[model samples]
Target: MLQRASNANQYFTHWVTAAPESRELLALCLRKLRGLNKVRIIDASFVWTEPHSKRIKVRVTVQQEAFEGAIIQQSFEVEYVVASQQCPDCAKSYTANVWRASVQVRQKVPHKRTFLYLEQLMLKHSAHKETINIKEVKDGLDFFFAQRNHAEKFVDFLSSVTPVRVKKSQALISMDIHTSTKSYKFTYSCELVPICKDDLVCLPIKLAKQIGSIFPLALCHRIGTSINLLDPNTLQTADLPSNTYWRAPFASLANATELVEFVVLDIEPLGEQSGRFFLAEATVARASDMGVNDNTYFCRTHLGAVLHPGDSVMGYHLTGTNFNDPQFQELENSSTYSSRIPDVLLVKKFYARKKKPKRNWRLKRMAKDEGELLPKKADQDRMDADYEMFLRDVEEDVEMRNTLALYKAENKKEADAMSMTETDLDDDDEVPKISMDELLEDFEDLQVGE
Candidate 1:
């Protein structure tokens, strides 16, 4: 009887806040109200004493709490007591620093290309839906969540896309001694390996041999659950798992920023094939040294089918460039590995730059808080350069496009008018064009959010 009285008191206190409109609906709502126990409601009727009265008189018929199966009837009057109050969740949103969990993502690289790629992956998978706030810090982006589970899910998503190491910690926020209940703030420090696609990685000799007998110098072909490294000389590829990578961490000797433009003077197929790449010997000259010096270099590359006499390409000038890495030092000091290093390592074939280039496809970006302090001019320039390079990568690489969601441009007539020049450019087979079938029509404008 005490428990029944307690449940009835709790239920009726909030009943007037959501009273049903019609008499039948009110009776049905009363029947479903959570209070009655050891008693089954058979019928409920409501009577208004006055036409516009604020009180409702109700009679409920229920089964008695006994094996004899007696029927009992009760009548009660419910009065309206309306007051304005804020719910806990709504109040919490209005306050600051109330997040229970946070994930700090950091990459020690100089450029933001990696973050751009990560953002695209997050968008493709809809991984940031649960985040309450995303803030851009000094080195990386921070994701804030209301719960620890959401932060853990974000950490898992980061682990699946790139090679990252995570450290977890929690701080006691508040404690209740009477009930022995406590509140804690959780934080996850996630650090990504400072290597990106097309980066020239000088692997540790021992680690290189353990994963695959590929050369110590390799190119980061792609990043997924593991670091995919490809030997430019032999076209041999190896996947460095996240666990194995953390066991012996290594940094890149050079990244795409150090790439030098070279014009292909001559190329010949060596009749060797590996997937989409083919072995060939190419004679290239530095674009800067084209007219100033007649110096040309003969090096072997994997892009045999794509290279032509007049095509320009980008590669690392490894001949006289000094690297301060331990692995590079080891390779330099050892006679066995010294001869295997190439003078110029070709990264990718270059394309003609348009005077005014416009894309008919667009990528969705996450609305992130970049913090209050504005970035320095140099830092902003570097970020713009990285984003531009990433955009070019998406346009040139079909495999990359497959992993991202591309929406058709909002301006159809402008896109159609620009298509003519694109068609003309595609005729030379130098520029890559994304098929219209691959683009998704954006209907975001039609959506009405609640």
Candidate 2:
């Protein structure tokens, strides 16, 4: 005889095997397919009937979601057979049944409506005017000009509304420091060029901090060499009081060169600990020549921050060597060293602290629970009994006997020396030797040692 299987058999089996609740099963399935663009699940039903003496037939129908906001239907059919057999060795009778079922699952194509709607929203609500020269724009929306390729359109829009024609400009700044003389200088110049004002406004204190932090490690080797050059004996012991306004000689090279003009944006005090330090943000008149070796080189140097009269600025001599290569290499090495020491120590300490909780918590809880479980008198008696048992066990062990023998031999040597010393002291007094039988009698009268 052939037996039919229901369409819900495997589906229900998998669902039940997965979790106790249907909602959990559904959540797990959804999590598995989260990255899929479009997905649809169908409720399927099957009907089975015995068509012949040895075969069973099944018909299946499934409902699935379709693209373009419609429902899709699919169907399939299958058959199975049954046979009787006996085990060859055991002589056990058995019935064998084979069954098959066909099912069709449909998937829908992803719809493009959401993306189209977003595009429409962007076009409608976006700033219509090309150039938005607000005092400040949101950081996320500030790159609209480059992102949309609307630079020309924005400039055209700006020219029509504002009387001051929008023009691009470049700035130049130079910094120099003398270690022997302990002096520093900074000069700023501004030149008009062809760039947007949004790029110019990007200069701020945060940017200055980002640049200044790199200065210390970037010129570490140079600074170390300069410190070594100083006569240690002549080095001042007392910390010098920083001046309010320390002046250094500054030369404006931009005035002599027609390439780029620089303007001093603003100079503000960053923060004062032992000495004063300032951050200067400037606009470059020309962007083309704004590299380390170019007129803009000084802006990136250590001398960018003004120094006090006694304070020394640590930096490479930009006049003689390739400043960019050594500066970058030194920064990379310092950054690598900085990352290793702190990060490894932090991870080790974190895991060590994490591991301690298991033993610590257990000990604390055990102490608290033990206080209620055992009376003080009972605990004390138990400890005393345990200690006595331990001593007896140790005394009976063969290894412990050997250890005691070794200790006795060492003690015997010290006792023999003392006996010899006593004998030497008694040399002045005549001492008579005793017979073996008499000594044995004296030893028998002594009590046994523990």
Tens digit per residue, CA lDDT, model 1, 1-450: 001111111123332223234554454346555576666767766655663343345566665655476556555444433223444333444467689999999999878888888888998899999999999888899999999999999999998888899999988654444577777889999999988889999988889899878898999988888999988778899999989988888889998889999999999999989988898999999999988999999899988989999999999999989899999999887788988888999989998866445665677778888788577998776776676678779888878889888876665344433111122333345577777899887677456678
**Model 2 residue 229 lDDT?**
11
Question: Number of clashes in every candidate structure?
Answer: 0, 17
State the weakest 10-residue window (summed lDDT) of model 2: 343-352
lDDT of 2 by residue, 1-450 (tens): 322222111122233223212454334333333323353434322234442354433443456677887887766544434333222211211112211111111111122111122122333334233432211111111112212235444333323322112333222211112233221111111111111110111112222134332212211100000110110111111210112001211111111012122322222333322222123222221233335334422232112244322222222222222323333334335644323211000000001111111110000000011223343686555444433322222222333222221111121223322111111222212122122222112232357889
Deviation in Å, model 1, residue 90 alpha carbon: 19
Go through the candidates in order and give each one's C-alpha lDDT: 0.77, 0.24
lDDT of 2: 0.24
The residue-level lDDT of candidate 2 at 179 comes to 31
- Candidate 2 TM-score over all chains jointly: 0.13
- List candidate 1 segments past 4 Å from native: 1-97, 412-429, 447-450
Give the CA lDDT, 0 to 100, for residue 46 in model 1: 64
- lDDT (C-alpha) at residue 229 in model 1: 90
Query: For candidate 1, what is the lDDT?
Result: 0.77
- What TM-score number comes out for model 1? 0.75
